[model samples]
Target: MTIQVLPEQLINQIAAGEVVERPATVVKELVENSLDAGACAIEVELEAGGLNLIRVRDDGGGIARDQLALALTRHATSKISLLDDLERVASFGFRGEALPSILSVSRLALTSRREIDQHGWKVAGSGLLDDGSPQPAAHPPGTTIEVRDLFFNTPARRKFMKAEGTEFRHVDQALRRLALTRFDLRLRLSHNGRRSFELAQAEGDTARAARIAAVCGDEFLANAVTIDEQRLGLRLWGWVALPSFGRAQADLQFLYVNGRNVRDKLLAHALRRAYHDVMHSQRHPAFVLFLELDPARVDVNVHPQKTEVRFRDASVVHDFLFGAVHQLLRRIRPEPGQHHRVEFEAPAFSTPDPVQSSVPLSYGRNVSTPSWPVREASGASGSAWPLYRAGFAEPEMPAALNATEDAPLGRAIAQIRGVFVLAENRHGLVLVDAHAAHERVLYERLKLQLAADGIASQRLLLPEVIRVGGAEADQLEAQFESLRRFGLILDRAGPESITVRAVPALLIKADLAALLRTLCGGADDAESAEHFNEALDAQHRILADIACRAAIKANRRLTVPEMDALLRDMEQTPNAGQCNHGRPTWVQIDADALDRLFLRGR
Candidate 1:
């Protein structure tokens, strides 16, 4: 083949392959252009899931009559003029490829009139036309881009589109990402001739929350916590759902960098680490967060779609994000009446079966029946019953109990079947899963103790020799020192085997051989070091299991004082809102809800 220069039409069509992947990509590009044009009110109209037609109208500083044709020319942009300008580009459409690329693959008509112009001008183009001349059109002091027959010139790309609903959903999601950051702008979206949503300009915090509720859902807003923090020349503000509000998919996680929606892995990793201890496995936390920093400090040109960014100081950003979210989650206490508002509904418990019944509920070894203190017919403790034999001694009530109205968890009133603690405060009633609450308390305390005193090593009476692959043995030898941090000591017995000398004192009862094999199976490369850290994380989970075993279990009868002690401990402990498994430990039922249940007001 002879060397030849590609025509302008083919070059644009090729660029479209990178810039316009689907209808959603077109919507994202056009909407971003409208935003960059300083549009306060934008309307997006779609037909056939944006495949047949997509019209975006905006009231902003429109293009000039002479510049209308330039807008459809490749590499023509007004956002940046010099190399230094690209380094600190802030606008969403700085690349200048969106318009030309989209125009190449679709039938596009750009009509605009600047505020100073008396009449608007229209310019239409397709892949066959390089730069169609602008002609006189109706009056409008803004821009309206009408794109029809998307990917019409490229049959291969058009055939790859999904079903109508699926494609529309992607477009809706793209609009939502832009909507979350620009609360001051009014955005209206319509699909298949029917209006889908119309978000008005939100001016206050309450209205902004309403906008978020409209986009994410009322459930998210009901369960979310508001965050506002500024530090180190960075500002992060948004709402993060509580750990109990976790979702099975990460679809609801929206992160905006400097007002541009992005899905950077660095941010995701930070969020994962922050929620690691509290969130359930395979569950994702839902959040709508906005991060703002100096534009020069971040690079948005790393990806074709500008959906990922590279930070100059990723470590600093990671630490800042983790610390901010971690601190907030740690101090999260259950709010009054929060349980009844959203998805945090309390689990209903039925009354326990009669103690004298012939069939006693068997919960296996994990649960034990509590020995009730022996009492005389007069209801006084018998002289033969020793206090120490009761399992727990009652502590003196603090003076804080005098003001029960101000108590966060109220005051414990009764124990239900040794599994639940029922209490009352200003917020009507509070029900607590006694076992789950105790488990979290013990786990937190154990972690703290471990951190303070370091991992305690328990020597094995007999060294266990485990066989493994050559790579596994090599990894075991290489990661010996790192393994020591988890109190796991290993020796290379041979090319295919390793000897385990000791394990964490807390995991003495665990199957050491099985755990070592699991650890060895995860070591494959340098990144596999993270797997080693995760193995150590497994040790903490084992510790959690131990705490669960030691915690007070179901069918354990507790006196009022003992219940009060547990409640006080829960009130003081950090991250006490949810258990280790991400289940809420306690729920508050407001007095109004209780009244509604009984029709007391009526």
Candidate 2:
């Protein structure tokens, strides 16, 4: 092929291919330009998903009449002028290719007036246009860009457009992402003459939370925990949902870096590692986090869309983000006197067999020993009955034990079928799954101990040998050291066989071959390898399995004292609201709900 300079119009259309993939892309570029222009209020109007018409008006500093034509030319921008400016760019639109590339494929009309100008000037452009003369026009002291028939000149690109509704959803998502970063600005969006949303400027923390609730959902806000941490010149603040509130997909995760939305692999991995043991395997945690640091410490020009960033010190950033989220999740204990209730429909009734019911049954003596003395009913802050009082021995009894109603999980009254614990509090009733609750408590304790002191290993009497395929063996060999950190000692018996000589004391009862196979299978890819390394390095998964094995099982009878001790432990344990499997450990039924069920005082 002969080398020749391509036409400016062709060059621009090619650039447009990179910058404008759909109507949403067009909206992103234009809105970013407006943001860089210092717009506090931006309004967007779309028709036919922006294929037919897209009008964006922003109350920002407008262009002068003399510069209206220059604005249509490629590579002209007021945001940056030097290499230093590019190194530490704070503006959203620094390349100045958005307008010209957009103009190359659409019919664009730009009208603007500076604050000092009495009237605005209008300039119109079509396909392959280098410039357009500014004509006198009457307008406000801001800018309004009207784009019509996008990709009209490029018929092939137009053919690739999706349906109107799908396109509109993309535009809506783009707007939502931008809205999260700029709570101080007002954003209004309308589609086909119907207003989609009109968000006012958010001022304080309360208002910002309200805005987040409006955008994310009310349920997310109710289940989320606030986070604020600063260290090593980095600040991360946001709300992360409780482990039980996790979603099936990661669509709800919104992360921002220095006021710009980014989708980064390092950040995602850090978050996943932080919630490794606490969350279920099939679920993803939801969060809206913002990380702030000096501009020079990060690079945002890795992609044309600017949705991925690179940190100068990735390990430090990773550690900081992981530590912040991990600490926040670790401190999520249920507050005293706090209660939550969920209502369910009444169960259907079944007729009992009269003959079976007529038979009399003999009863045995109750095993519960009520010898421990109970204090008088005090306020919410009353001291709890100590679990370790005199090494579980029964103390001298009082006449009656007054169980207060102010406890968060209430005072245990009975064990239902040796599985659920029934309690009474300020709320109507509380039911807790003893097995799941104990599993979570033990899991957290194991994690703490593992963090403080490394996992203890048990030597096997005889080494167990297993054979595997060549590919699996290669992966196992590559991650041999990482697996050893989790207390799984291995040696290469042959090319396709390995011998396990020792295992973590906690996981001694677990299936050794299955776990090794899983680790090897997951190490086939880089991302999965990193994930497995982190989990094994912390021995989190192994600890979870151990906790499950060591926890109290269902249908295991307990004394009143043991039941009370379990309740007290749950109240003090972090993240006790959900078990290792992400299922809720306990549920509350409020007094009002009980009243409604019986139609009392009607």
Q: How high is each candidate's TM-score?
A: 0.82, 0.81
> Which ranges in model 2 have alpha carbons more than 4 Å from their true place?
336-340, 343-407, 452-538, 600-602
For every candidate, C-alpha RMSD to the true structure in Å = 8.9, 8.3
Q: Could you say which candidate leads in TM-score?
A: 1
Quote the lDDT for 211 in model 1. 87
Candidate 2 lDDT, 1-602, residue by residue in tens: 89999998898998898888999999988888888888899999999999999999998999998888788778898978988887787878778788889999999999998889989999988875534468889888889999999999999999999999899999998998889988988999999999999889999887888788778876677667778899999999988877877799988899999888889999999999778767888999999999999888898889888889999999999999999997777666554223235544332244657776665433221112111111222222111343222235664432322346445676778999879998776656778888888888777666665666555667888888888777767767776676665566888888888788888665565577776665655434555454345645335665676677656777877667666666767877776778887877887776655665445555
- Model 1, C-alpha of 331: deviation from truth (Å): 1.7
> How many residue pairs clash in all the candidates, one count each?
0, 0
Once fitted onto the true fold, the runs of candidate 1 whose alpha carbons sit more than 4 angstroms away are: 130-132, 337-403, 455-542
Per-residue alpha-carbon lDDT of model 1 for 269-341, expressed as tens digits?
9898778878887889999899999999999999999989999999999889988887778766545444422
Candidate 2, residue 33: Cα displacement in angstroms equals: 1.6
The global Cα lDDT (0 to 1) of model 1 is: 0.77
- For candidate 1, give the lDDT of residue 390: 42
Q: Count steric clashes of candidate 1.
A: 0
